[model samples]
Target chain A: MQDALHAALLPQGLHDLLPPDAGHEAVIVERALASITAHGYERVKPPLVEYEAGLLAGVGAADRDRIFRLLDPVTQRTMAVRADLTPQIARIAAVRLAHAPRPLRLAYTGEVLRVVGDQLRPERQFRQVGCELIGSLEPTADAEIIALAAETALGIGITGLTVDLALPTLVPALLEAHGITGAARAELETALDRRDASVLAARGDEVGRMLADLVNLAGPVDSALKQFASLALPASAEPDRARLFAVVAQLRGRVPAVPLTIDPVERRGFEFQTGLSFTLFARGVRGELGRGGRYRVAASNEPAVGVTLFSDSLLRALPPPARTLRVFVPVGGDAAKLREQGWITVAALGPVDDARAEAKRLGCTHVWIDAAVSEIA
Target chain B: MTPPPNLARGDLIVLAVPKGRILDELRPLLRAVGIEPEAAFDDDESRQLRFKTNLPSLEIIRVRSFDVATFVAFGAAQLGVAGNDVLMEFDYGDLYAPLDLGIGACRLSVAEPSDLSQSDDPSRWSHVRVATKYPNITRKHFAARGVTAECVKLNGAIELAPSLGLCQRIVDLVSSGRTLKDNNMVEVERIADVTSRLIVNRTALKTRPEEIGGWVERFREATARNA
Candidate 1:
């Protein structure tokens, strides 16, 4: 039988990002930040751990289960390791930059640890690079964040990328407008999320018909909107429909090259989404590269839209970074000089007979001997 | 992914299915979908984790019920059969449940020993301790009713907990309620009805809509015919 240590091994869903891949993820994140930074987004650094109350406040309240809680040794109060940086960034925007200025453009890169990993993301720990455009409730701001996400993926050299835009509140507004409230409303919403027509039809004739029509309204952006335009939407929901159209129009005008699809009533993972939201994906990639949408700050009376790129999956979609020639130099050699020569330099810590073999074993392609470099044979 | 010696071709699409009873129920659906697995796939004695299907582009993997969502969500597998019970517990944003396969029907419920349940009033309880496979669902259910639930997460054999003093109640999946009855337990509150769904990676559907949509349609038709 295995020992207790073996039983204790790998609490599941935890993973280590190693070597070239780890560095590649970092580089991709940096380039993505640069792309967003070009759009006037300044960087922010939030603490890795915070008071559970602060972290769980407002829009972040739903993530209570995802957080890893620990008792603070000094204060004896509950603390939480951030499972998501978006909420913390939202908190930062509301408090730290509360008085900074109107329309705060903030970017952040940090590691988040989750209590458990999901189907598409099985890593408990991963890096996130994201940007938020605050203080804007405009359709242009929503469109800008979407364009920025697509462009950022492009900036990281990812091609054939697609951005799926979803309006989280559309259905709620529709259901409320149609007088489907409380339990019935939630049940109807679940039916929509699952695309289960049977459950939807069981609700009632009129409600079922409207929801089924709404489900059919999801497809390519142009076609879905055309369908939405034809429908006689309620007066209360007209504004939401109008804003969605405007956001789509802005995206079409700004970045026509990036293919955009519409999922009008998708509410999953958009718990904090207030208006237009989007998810980023690339051709041949398994998971979402990034996701962002419009949301209201929990305490601060400001509107915000942000996009967070998951480096774990983003790097997977991206082509492998061009390998830099790695050269090994014997101890006492000028390793720094080789670095300036545009090669990754490794230094031998101990003496070795076969310099070539040592260099290859160390993952270096070249070895230096007597101030001369030669490819490992 | 590299193909094993047993597989004839390259790794194409991986479909994750929960092992045991669900797999048994899914056999007819798989055959209806026009895919046939190698003979070893049905061999209970075989210890293989993955099996080759007649369609070279498609493969099958058997894992824990909870893991189907993870595999598909991560894109390690493009398609999966996952219960909404697992889906609700994990709440994977990356997964898209396009269809309810209408198989593996059950309900997630709150249960207690037959004796305790007779005297128990779930509505009057301010705080409750429970054993459950779904802590998130349990907590959310209790929280919705203005009750705080302290949950002890267990993998299986939850009915034994109530009698052994692990907890007076358990939140678990109830199919025919046979296990609960055998253990002298009774279900008090049902959280949600459960069923298997055709879960696909959200990105996979968007990237290769034709291929993924085709499979989704086949599964949908097969389910409809069976139903």
Candidate 2:
């Protein structure tokens, strides 16, 4: 009994996906991949594990701690399980497919394993479905990626979506312009990251007051943009604000039905991002459904942006998929014909006394009788 | 069929509050923010854990002071009122202490027996043992100054530890210092000045900015009125 109990236990933040959930996850991945592929994005499959040096090169530098590493016995070299797939796509774009094309579009779906988990999202092993557009510096690229993300989610039955746009570089650019460096810069950054307006208000400096005002500008797009347009920004940080406004305008032009909001100072989880970023959320979902932004490809330094959807969070946002109608076929029945008719046919291994009773026992909705499908209930 | 009022707008927003002396100071603040809980909430003898407010989209849950941070950090409750002492002790990255409520004034201090304090020098100490409900804060406070603190965790009656030889000192919240005087102890050090804060879940703030940010603004005005 003790051994059985121990066998049932898995390591923290890891679990098995069983039954209807596994099937539903597969459906969602396939639907999302097809939708992305329809927009001329080709699918690519990266391995689950790779050499630590090759895996953690370039963009993977910041993610070293989160990756699960082990030593390869044959080669005696270190290997690592990928904690994220976007870095791999970047590596491919820079190395393997370096000469493929300009503004290369690649889509991917695979499982990622992490070393640790936080209280909010405890799943260490989960699937990621995302697409990256590499080698583009256009604001339209940002707008396209965001619109595609929202459309892909809507195509998969997610509703009430809101995309919150962020400019991670805006505040840092402001601080650089002000020459506020050393400990003061670090303190102000922390205060901004925590959204602590009180601490910023206490500073009472011009920069401090500006940052406090930015903290309060995290709401709807029109009103926040109205307030943002009136701010007296330095010449250096003005481009970031202008670029954010342009992207917002483009996104509205592209997907006017989807809700858009602005958070000018949201920099967390976008440390690697270089420019405009956005996070997708449903009305009542607990966490972000998907997020992406502009980042420079590590090795090539080509500007890029991508969106990755957490399958676990996406599953929660979507309503449970409708159950497929399964029809039970007894021995000598035309199971193939039943399947061709768009019914999931469960074939009988041996003869049964009653086809309807057998269908009910096997959890089928219908049974094959006299060369025709009959409803079981 | 018509939907419930809370669901009609969105998910019901749960606000967690501490269940002790802080509740007395919080009553008027809650009213100023336009939240009035059911009459049974004031009885003190009710076993109820959750109570509805006058607002259709809001509700309140009474929990232990320390647990208030845990609830909001987990996003089980989208908003809460907790002392900074609990915030520092947990240091949950998911919480954003955006506003200081200016209530529940106190200080987290280290105290010991009067005789020990008379001849004791904190600078000369190499290692010290202390009892506290906030082991994280106590250890961190000592470690910042190149000292090692062996903390024995206790939930309540931390003042009894020093007198019973459990430890030479205890770290606990001191409001008036009367509890220490009654135990024949004297204050040795103050870690931080404590006050209740308006804590919002990081995710809630991002997902529902209008609703949650509106609440923060409302509370800001309420605190200002009280000041």
Candidate 3:
């Protein structure tokens, strides 16, 4: 086998996160982590690889084959590259954070690999910057996570962003209230996910019809909330509905400034979401910049919620942040002085003409002369 | 249904098609439904992620089977074809799997080593630890029996679980059961018989009902003809 050839062709679902794109992605992640940190979300770095068993512990079957698994030569145990950071975070929270305080807030930024086909618009290797608020079932936690996500997006210059929200709890409650069995619930969710109202109407009972209708409701926050309120749901179903509404209300009261909408039928990405879920979309972007929701412990039944921004997607929708000081340090110039001024200086050793072109290419607003020791504005 | 205002008029209707085995099986089905993808679609060596179909209005994107649900659920692709396995795994609330294409036929089942099957009675078990690709379905299947199933999820090679002592039983899709037989496993319980279904984004279906519904009808007719 040609190792070089294989290396050159780099397998599907893996790619080199090259130069400026890589650098810019790093900067974006730093900013995201800073913002999340300022909100008292601490950071955690999980290993990029874990035992296959540990990695797959609570992950669903559909995602099993998507992981890049290989036998660890040292231990002879099967290991997998991280496909999602959430599970690892959960594992950490279960073990390490068990002794920690309630409502643990932790932030993470890292690469995740999924065995996606080469044809998907999303890259197989993409950066995710997110924060998980664990051990809290409070609706305020849900609202706060979403609010932070909105703020982080704005902080990164992602404007005109629309956050489409949903609740996993409500769907199940509605199914139970309508006497829909587990199997029927699965089928109805499948139907709702596909947006086939005809099928939903055909297969769904009265509750399915109402749930399906709610799943399709999307628009301004107030109207969406009113539509949900008018569902006239029984007392048993009220808590889930109230939690969903509370998250919305909290967002309105706390971060009322952010452009938020209530999408009743906005049944996007419920597979992993256990409670409140949302996807942030900006005008002109083809896909979501970030998406996440509460993830309940399948084993211990603990409550957890977090949001991960596809940094690559966010980068595409947002203009690179304005460069602070574009210092063009000429060849053999005092690199130390530019450092003192805290300028992002680019060192160029080419001819004077090439130096000018380099300055233009680097988008430097000012060039410093090496020999003359003068700054060129 | 009028096209959603968010979508540009000339924007092609991206169809999220699952890659690998299903793509191979779906090629004929796609053609049956009047979609002829570019030659590059057939070339496994191709690096292209998105491809154009013969229809100007339709483009095909090959994604993971799991992502087919996510893509369509989020309305990233207005349409998709995914197995019930993928459908059960994510169970996105907004997607509508209107028509059963009946391709990629298989069953989601609980299997154990043939040796273990002799002593194991699923009905008698109070609690069981199982490794599976489908935790939701597995949990639900066992929960119905009043058995607390501690499921250790694995992405693939579920057949290897029993031998490795990861778990005594595995829940996965059984097609020919060749993979199970090779691993000395036998089906102990059957979950749902699986098949690929034509899935559409609910919003896409509602807002562009006529167009999406027409496609659904076309696929329904195609499946009927095949049947």
Candidate 4:
């Protein structure tokens, strides 16, 4: 019964990050945070839990059904374990740092718990480290965020990184301005999402051809833009197209080696994004390294661009982390010197009979013997 | 016994494809996409689970229809062909379905025995007990209508549920009315239209865009030919 009680059983979608992976995840978080901070991003720590309504107010409203809520005994108000940190960051930018300078750069790193794990990410809890530029709408700002994300991945030795840029509202804005609304707009959105040009053709011919022209404009940025260069667009959507083009152009100059793709119709995960949104992926990795784009601060109309890297996936994609060399030290010996020599000292509490055996038992790779550290045999 | 070869990270690209009925239509699509798997891949009698393809670094993994989504989502396999039904049921944020393969056409439906349908008004029901493979989708569907759906999660044999008193109604995939009639049940509502999709991990698509995107275009061409 005791053994059974001590069993490492855990709920589905939850896991214990044993040994090196746990330490590796922390290292990745630190390294990514360091990369973002180099660009003048100050770090902020949000509470792991917050008032449900406040946390779900703006960009986070999309994660409505996924938050875990509990009643607070003191205030009698419902409290929520945060499922996402972007909304919390937005709230901070809008309220707490309301008086801060323009383009408020804030970085954060922490764990989030979700009610159910998505298919790719089966962990109910995972770490998210991100930087949010809270007050700029320029295409240059978008380029900077993308470049910073690329730099973070590059810092960790991820090469062949590709950025998929999307103008979520561009197509919808164009269709609406061109008299596609209500059921028609929804149908067209579905058609574009599925790449089903037939549905567009069956419903309305003129709109169908226009959508075909737009949806076909997805590929390498240069070719895609050249296609968009000739096509007529709705008058109102001109700025959106222009901004996306400008962002792409600026991003090209900054990260010359990174490949870029443009897909104008993808809005599945970018519900709250106002203008441009981008997702980052690299060769051979299975999930997105990070993704972010444009959004407004909680109460302000100002634009913001940010990216959040998934620590778990990043660690998985990275090579095995370097283990700290640990040496077993005898009691009343030069433990401080071992520390100064760069060995992680595991000191014995008392005088030991066999330093080698003690080192082996304690899982230490080395032992202090006769004033010198030697490999345990 | 030796375990299957472990693919070193970035050394190879894996494609997860469904093993059974769907493969009948999928083989031609694979051909159109110019992917020719080894002879052992098509052998139902073969115990081997993974097979090498004509391309040096690409391979095929045969698995259950639902598992295709999981494997691709987790990055065990970077690409997969899965039905939207499985996609909706799992909802993996990391799995991005770029193209609808236009194969495996079907619909998910709610069904009940014919006798129960005459006197029972589903609209007036406050609560329902349903046996289904898709409990999440079942609950969400009924919840949207202000009805409580208590779903008993089951793996297959949904046709026998009503007779066995497992539940009054069952939600299952309907390829035709034959299964419903044979079970003394009738289709009452459609949950969603189903179709196979070419899904890729969002990260995989970005990191290896040239290779992944090339396959996407090939599959798109194949799908276009099929259409």
Candidate 5:
């Protein structure tokens, strides 16, 4: 009965990380952390549960619903499992890491919960490995994050991937400069989001018409950016547009041969992005491998940028890495000789062929033939 | 698993259903069109994200209302149902909203504390700070009138913003005005009347014209009959 209860009570949206899968995930996560840390990003671990208000204070409503909520019996206050790591990282940057330094680079790897609909075929309980480079308004920060994301994907064996880029500030700035009202702007932007040119045109404003026209513009980055170059941006916004172009130029310079496209009206995950936003997609996968963008400091009017790789998706798209093994064996046996000769060995109590097969299946390149194996063989 | 067979280029059809409110509203429409989802779909308490419909060739995935456009735009889901509000939010270029289901009736509007309505004149304001779920929409709405609106973007509970002093005004969806009245707010402006739309992935429609277009026409007919 106790065993049955334990089996039945396994937490929903949470599961035990089995040996081989767990080891594979751990290796990928460590590699991602090492890559980010090498680029001057410090690693930090945020709490698995945070005060409900702290998590929801500035997060969007849709995201608020996704968090796993509970009441802390001791305090009788609501608490929520961390559904996303970015916000907690933001809070840390705002409160704890405020005095760290200018352009603080931070990286983290953890599990995030989303009570996703069961109809979605992906795992709801999964790991997120990512980095956030805060306090930098430079395009270099954006380029570094994007490059890191691409490199991490390649490291995990995900090929034929492309990064779709969009600027959330571009269209909004244009609407503001054209004297569009807030409500009308929302309406027009919604139209643009839907790509409803007729709805945008119906607004009867030259700016809305121009934005509607721009929403249809899509192509390789160079052509799209060149087309956008012709727009008459205001003096204050010229720098932002220039910065966007500069970011594209830098990405081209650093990762010259990667496929990058500019989707000016792309609105997939712009809900949280304040500047350059991107989503990574592979050839066969239905969803994005990862997504991240620049988020503004909610408290102070400062620029911040970061990216997070959905490690679960990454693993799904790539083969598991090889595991290292050192097997112990009885002395003065075939396995002992194998171990002495630099092969991984364990005291073999079974057939040598079975042991070698098991080792190979577990991604161990070397296998030791123990005394028990010699006795059997 | 195995990426669900790569969606078969043109042989398969995936339908994207917006979870929650619209899912409930769409049940009857789906039944009318002969595409009932599995029983688990009706169990709102279920955690499943994808479900099989009555037809072997068709499947449904329940995602956030805003993601319907994304799913369809990326060809992840060949078809979807989304509110005009959502359609307005992400505006995916590859999606084409051809049919209006006429359900999920609501209006996107600007709301402020009821007391402020007595003295507030929208036309007289030179600048405003607004809390909204739709920043692009909110900023564009204000900018049209030459009013510089500082938008504080909130994902949900835009109504609570006014009471919490997060902002004096909020732009959100108003269905019955009960939420606003309960929060001591009044409608000050309207953004757009919203309804759920039948959106088809353009690439899907182009590739499987008959099969995909046939589903569209069937839904359109069902909508017409219901009307």
Candidate 6:
């Protein structure tokens, strides 16, 4: 009994997806990928594991700690289980399809494994579905990715969705402009990451005042933009800010219905993002549904932007899917014919005295009786 | 954990507050922010966990200090008042401490018996045993300076550990010198300054910016007035 109990226990931050939820997650992933692929983003399937150096070359370097390492038996070299699919997509765009097109559009959906999980996202292994547009530096590319992410989420029934825009590099540029480095920079980084206002209150310098204003300036796009326009940024960061302004304007024109907010200092997950980035949120959802932003392809200079949605979080945002009508078909009944009419047929193994009782026992909503469908009730 | 049923009401907001000592300081701030909970909220003996405020859309829940970060971080409660000590211990990424209320002034410090500190040199020590509620912060503080800390967890009355020989040292919050003196202990090193902050859930601020940002602005004004 002790051995049996031990066998039932899985590793922490991992679990088996049982029954309807498992099926529901697959359907959602398909719907999401379909919506993304509809925009001519041809799908690509990357392996679950790859050579460590190849996997962790560029943008993937940030995720080195999270990737699970294993020694390949053949080459005796280290292999890493992919912690994020964006890097794998980047590798493909650089090496496999390097000469394909200027703006290569690729879509992928696969399970990713991590060494551990954070408190906000506790699933060490979960599916990521996303599309990346490579070899494009245009603000329109950023706008397209944002619009596609919103469209995919909206199409899948995530209500009251919000797309929060952030420029992760903006704050660092501001700090660098003021010669803030070493311990002081680290302190300010932590303060900004936690969105703490006390740091601003304590530091009364010109930079401090500017950062505080920016923190308060974070809000709805219209008002925040109005306030942001008056704030002056260093010349070195002007291009990034200009790109953001362009993307925001383009996004407003394209997907105006989706709510947009900007936080110039949000630098949590976009460690490698060089330009505009956005995180997707649905009202009342526990965490982010997905996030995407601009970056360079691994081992190459090709500019890219993509959005990766968490299937688990997306499931949380959506309502429990409508139950499929399962009709109990008698042993001799035509199961295939009933299935064609959109009824999930659960056939009887043997003849039953009462079809209604049998249907109720098998969790079916309907029963095939007298050559017609009848409600279980 | 399942969120509270009222969380589904987009118009309503929940503010989780620490139940004990900080409540006195928070009261005036709450009043300044135009929030008045029912009179029962002030009753120590009242077995209420939640109370309706003067604001029709806002409610307040009183919980343990540590749980305030937990509540707000999980989006179970959209807003909370938590100390920086608790915030540093948990270091929850979901919580954004946008305003420093500047209340609950204290310091998380390493404390040992008065006699031990007389001969003890913190820089010379390689390893030490401690008793405290904040093991994470204690371990981090010691590890930063090449000291390996073995912390024995104690929720309350941490000062009693040294006398009982459970541990020779402790890492706990020091508000005044009275408690350490009463327990025959002295502060060795201070880890971080402690103060309560106005924390908002990241997702809450993102999804309901207008409503949540409004509260943050109001709190900012209230704190500025106090300062």
Best by DockQ: 6
DockQ-based class of model 1: acceptable
Candidate 5 Cα errors over 4 Å, as ranges: A1-19, A57-62, A74-76, A117-122, A175-190, A202-204, A233-237, A298-301, A320-367, A370-377, B1-227
Q: Residue A90 lDDT in model 1?
A: 88
lDDT of 5: 0.75
lDDT (CA) per prediction:
0.83, 0.88, 0.76, 0.83, 0.75, 0.91
RMSD, model 3, all Cα superposed?
11.7
Best by TM-score: 6
Which scores better on DockQ, 4 or 5? 4
| CA deviation > 4 Å runs, candidate 3 | A1-8, A59-62, A117-120, A177-187, A203-205, A234-236, A264-268, A298-300, A320-332, A346-366, A370-377, B1-227
**If ranked by TM-score, best first, what sequence of candidates would result?**
6, 2, 4, 1, 3, 5
- DockQ-better candidate, 3 vs 5: 3
lDDT by residue (tens digit), candidate 6, A1-377: 34455767888889899868899999999999999999999999999999999888777887888999999999999999999999999999999998897799999999999999999779899999999999999999999999999999999889999999999888888988999999998998888878876698579888888888788889899898898888888997888789889999999898989999999888888888888899999998999999999898866888999999999899888899898789999888888988887778899999899989989998999999889999977
**What DockQ results do all the predictions give, each relative to the true complex?**
0.31, 0.56, 0.12, 0.41, 0.05, 0.83
Against the true structure, candidate 6 has what lDDT?
0.91
Residues B115-214, candidate 5: write the lDDT tens digits.
9999997888899999987887888888988998899988787888888888899999999999999999999889889999999775455334457758
Off by over 4 Å in 4: A1-18, A49-53, A63-81, A178-216, B1-8, B98-102, B106-131, B136-154, B163-170, B173-176, B179-195
Give the true-structure RMSD of model 4. Answer: 3.9
Per-residue alpha-carbon lDDT of candidate 1 for residues B1-227, written as tens digits (9 for 90 to 100): 56655555313778999988888899999999998998998999999999888887888998998999989887778899999999899877667787888899999998888898777766798999999999999999999889999999999998899888988989999999999999999888889999999998777766665577679889989999999
DockQ of 5: 0.05
Note the B-chain TM-score for every model. Answer: 0.95, 0.96, 0.93, 0.95, 0.94, 0.95
TM-score between candidate 3 and the true structure: 0.60
